[model samples]
Target: MGSLDVIARALWSALLLCVISFSSPLRAQPEPIELWHGRVKADQPFLDKLFKQFTAETGIPVHLRYIIFKNLKVELIGAAFSNAMPDAIIAPADFLGHYKELKLPAIPDSEMPDTIRPRFLKTVELDGKRYGYPFFYGNNLMMFYNKSLVETPATSWKELRVMKPYYDKRNIELITFSYQEMYWLVPVIGAYGGWPLEGKKPMLNTPAVISAFKFYKGLVDEKLVQSDCNLQCSLLKFEQGKAAFLIDGTWSYKRLEESIGDDLGVAVLPYIDGKPMRPMYSSHVLAFPDYESQGEKQTKLDKLRDFIFRKDVQRQFYDEIGQIPTHKELASLVEHTTDPNRKAHFHQLEHARMMPIEPEMSHVWQSLIRGWERYSMHGFSAEESAVYMQKTVEREIERDTQ
Candidate 1:
């Protein structure tokens, strides 16, 4: 136990410890990527399984946080200001409108697939630079009818007009829809070849817009449509067999199927002035928040986007969630399946116009809806309603500018 013997023993022990640490084949693990999504609250099991696959294949672990869909933008903005934004965010397409202002990076074009944009990626793109890819689209509207009541679906507005009296005689209301809402009204407006906005100005007062209002009024006047129909009311009317036809979005299919059973038939909207009744559509998107485009985080984001959008993944999500595919290859397989109603839905979606994704779209929706309620439910004429819409929207725009 002399001083030299004690020192040698301590040195030998330290050397052995160093060798064991170096030979153990473990190093500092990289930080897990954080992803914020709103859908996990309801789809946690699906997301959990899909995410496990993502991690397994790429070896990039992720932390998924569920923010409420409505609050996602606010949360992301808060995160940005606090310098704690997640590595990525999964939000509805409208939320991406603030990406540039939030300093988020555009997804590299090379990493995006061309098949998706034609159908699903509609409003998510801005100024030719897309910020993200669509995860799923279920926003398009379609015509739902009772096959037992109506032997054949209406092919034109004129046909529906003619068939109304027959259905009325049978004690069935001809048609009904969520007529008070702007999203519901936008489809009819577009079908008549009118849109609510051109850039930032209101295009609510046009020949087509006036015609659409007139058409709506005619449906009410002829007793072919419920005058003040709304979501719950219309669904009730249709489900109870009080209404022969209902205009609803793709999301309403399951409920209708459950309520109406095998007699539930889906159809492309009847034509207007020789054109198909166009519907408004949109989807949720996956995006990155202010990450360097060529950096490590961006590379990981790229891989995630590419991986999630694969045809197999798209099919799996559609099978589980009933989201219509935007992938070219998968779209065919999904729509060509035995589900004729789903095929019809995809057909209508193909022709549907996507709702605008700009921040000003909020003002447009509210202004148009206010005017619509006045015109459709109250006694205001189409002209008077148009004037109100234009003025209200212009005032809102000016206020925003100020």
Candidate 2:
């Protein structure tokens, strides 16, 4: 055991160790991509199965966290300030209103697939940049009636009033809806030739707005519509056949179908003064917060985005969850469906208007809700309430912008 021989043996061992380390680097495995959503527990099994397929195909893991729908924005802002944002979120189109606070990156046009329907594209695009990819659409309102009570659906508000006497004789209410909710009120405003927004500006104090308020009040005062009815009350009364007509969103279709079966009849919202009633429609979207800073993870998220738009994936969403796909090709198939209810939904969509996605819209909603409360409950004149809405929303917008 010469000293030179011992030194030579140590050198050989060190070289071999270096070669092994280089071949199999000690780099840590990446964490699973986190996605936040407000989907109900009933959707768990489907989402689990879908993500499982995604992971299997791409070798990337995903983790889903459910936040209550109402609190998602607040929680997201908290997470952002703490520098703990998730990889992505499945949010309603309104979430785009928080783009600046959340640092959500605009998805480049080239990255967006051509298959996305043009209408849905507008939901994600704010100003000149796109912020999200639409997953599914259809929050539009429609008219539903129990065919056993009403033989023919009315085509206009005047015609609907004509049926009140027939309904009175049968001891059935003519119609029921969420009279106090701004969402329902917005459509009536549209029917009266009013729109809440005119290219990012609020237009709440107009002749049409005052007329809409008066007309809505008249419906209650005349007993032409059920007063003091919330969504649940309306649904229950309609299901039990106490109410002959109901105005509800597309989301209620499955429940109504189950409750009334073959007796369920759906139609477009009735006209007001020869102009069609226009309901607001919106979509749930996939958004990436801090996307530009995702670094190495950006490529993986891109794959996930593209995967959601696959024809087979879109079809699965439609077939399983009854979500209308945002793909134009699939939407065309829905348009030609043989099912009567499906056809009715498409017809309603055709007549509906896209809801505004601007950040200012948040202020508008809050202001309108306050105005409606005063007009409907506090004995304020329709003109006064309309003026209050316009002034309140303007101040809120100015304050926030400054």
Candidate 3:
């Protein structure tokens, strides 16, 4: 009788334990920190290496989705509207304000370099809140010259003209930039103290800008710059020793180094009217989206803060991806590197200006290109082109506003 009672009690207790175990929740996996990156698939390995370190250090899982730069803004806008946005986005600084207007919270990172503060502040700050933190910031134009072609790089158009005979003797062009594209024309126009806009209003007809165009026309007239070449053709010419000087951004540093090796050199654009041709700079920044979950936001903020601000991490990006580091302390290291073929782009960056980030800017690119086409292909005089550019920009900008 005692054995039967004992056995029945033991069996009941085992069944109760089985029921409790079945009712309780299974072990839940850690949620991935959702991140959106505009890097292409070819960059997947590098991105994987970058994120692996962050995950290793924090034990936080990260899921990075590839979105190309061209589609980043529109797709992100759609995501914002649909409430399906990522916790963080790695994007060019151009859209910082746009994202801020979308109500993405900007978490302040006092760890950022003071050198980067002004640009970030100018782009993202409103009423004293910064909306983006600096990540890596060096895609601006500089002059790359082949030492074998010229003893020294020309310091001005005047010097370039005088040296033209040497290249001409060798059947080489003195300098062959993408003459038709207006994108790189800023430095030349800015050399004369003119820019495309004056605070959302078009300034294409500024006397300085007109003079800038005439100056280029003179170059074309002198046969110093090729009028018919695109960037690829010009770059090919430079690579083939058919040209000596090329104007391109820091993004080409490694490629040129690979092509020409130690013969390559980088310097600021030549001067005109005592002002250097200061190109506009573009940079990457860490931006956040307003997340519904506080924990997700915190996880993103923590991971980005931990990964981007480290001196070692910045150095790793510089070494591995050839991304110029924005941390002030790393600047000197890059500037002083054994590679004369490369310079810390920041020194030249100091003289450069930030592009207009306002909504009207979306209208300026196509309008200016069209104006240039009218002048070159439709027989508009310099004065006529200047006036046409002014009207077109204003009209397009007005349209954008409406």
TM-scores for all predictions:
0.74, 0.85, 0.78
lDDT of all predictions: 0.78, 0.87, 0.74
Worst 10 residues of 1 by lDDT: 38-47
Candidate 2 C-alpha lDDT tens digits along 1-402 = 699999999999999999998999687875688999986444667788999899999988999998876688899999999999999999878789789888898778898889998978887779988888997898888999998887889988899999999889989899999877788988888888888987799999999889988888888888888678988799889999999999998767767876798999998888888988889998889888999888999999988998999999999877766678899999889779998778888888888888888998989889888887899889999999999999999999999989
Which segments of model 1 are wrong by more than 4 Å? Answer: 1-49, 52-87, 101-103, 113-122, 161-173, 199-201, 217-223, 227-229, 236-242, 254-261, 292-303, 332-339, 377-379, 398-402
Q: Each prediction's Cα RMSD?
A: 5.8, 6.0, 5.3
Q: Clashes in model 2: which pairs?
A: none
* Residue ranges of candidate 2 with Cα displaced over 4 Å: 1-30, 40-45, 165-172
Instruction: Write down the lDDT that model 2 would get.
Output: 0.87
Q: Which ten residues in a row have the lowest lDDT in candidate 2?
A: 38-47
Q: Candidate 1 has which clashing residue pairs, if any?
A: none
Q: CA shift at 191, candidate 2, in angstroms?
A: 0.9
**lDDT score of model 1?**
0.78
Q: Quote the positional error of residue 27 for candidate 2 in Å.
A: 12
With a 3 Å backbone cut-off (N, CA, C), the pairs that clash in candidate 3 are: none
Off by over 4 Å in 3: 1-45, 61-86, 100-103, 106-120, 126-129, 169-171, 227-233, 291-297, 332-347
Candidate 1 has what TM-score? 0.74
